[model samples]
Target: MPPLVKLVLIVVIVIAAVVIWGRVMGRRDPDREIVGLTDAVRAKVSREISAGHKINAIKIYREATGAPLADAKRAVDHWFVPGQGPGVRDAAASYTAGRLTDEGRARISELILAGRREDAMALYAEATGAGSAEAQAIIRTWDTSQHY
Candidate 1:
């Protein structure tokens, strides 16, 4: 084949490949991504993020959704964008199943008082190494188990 013809053929093939790829792999919607994440998974991701555990949150998000780490990180970051999260700007304490420090207990109370339940779970997880669901269970008894 002539050099000019070869070049034209190669360009045409590349263009065809590009068009096919675009059609097969449609653009991902950032706002609509991670749609299958359960509410519990969301709470866990949010909890990890709130407790300053970005990597863990990303890992959890990735594992739960099979999303790439970068995508999970982006989604996790989006969770705290003022109006994006569960409206939690603060974090707090340990849990009964964990180390539950006095400070942790007090902070848990504060978090509960502020109505930031998810953040309270995150805090409990932070101080005591409790899992999200465990932290939530323990937090549920905060009012009933204590004299506060």
Candidate 2:
């Protein structure tokens, strides 16, 4: 065998080993790891949740736990709030009371699908009399994905 052929063989073997190692390590139970998180991180996330900053709490939980996005969101939703169980605010609950109509929601979904997120936010805020921050937060909770 030529020298270059031996080198290529070595590289391929090393790449395969690394990929296999990664697959095994990635199989660790995320639920267990999240359950075993430190008290300090739990306290920080709790404070963020208590303040009604759900998005911030999710980001902090993700950064600290290194959990997948869905896992982080689920964990955040499980945190207890003052008056709610697991603190999971429904997407509909994010909207301003008596302001967001069913037709308005459909229009916003359409705008979002058309890649007009900013316009959608503006329209939501205008229609609902919500602040910019409130509108953006509500928008983040919307299920914008279209399914057949």
When superposed on Cα atoms, how far off is each prediction in RMSD?
10.7, 13.6
- Candidate 1 RMSD to the real structure: 10.7
Could you tell me how far off, in angstroms, the CA of residue 124 lies in candidate 1 after the best superposition?
16
Give one digit per residue, the lDDT tens place, for model 1 in 28-93.
455655546765676677667667798998888876786765677788887642112342222233
lDDT by candidate, in order shown: 0.66, 0.68
What is candidate 2's lDDT per residue for 57-91, written digit by digit as tens?
A: 89778767666677879989877542243433333
List candidate 2 segments past 4 Å from native.
1-24, 28-91, 94-96, 145-148
Off by over 4 Å in 1: 1-35, 81-148
Top of the candidates by TM-score: 2
TM-score of 2: 0.41
Cα displacement (angstroms), candidate 2, residue 47, comes to 20
- Itemize residue pairs with steric clashes in candidate 1: none
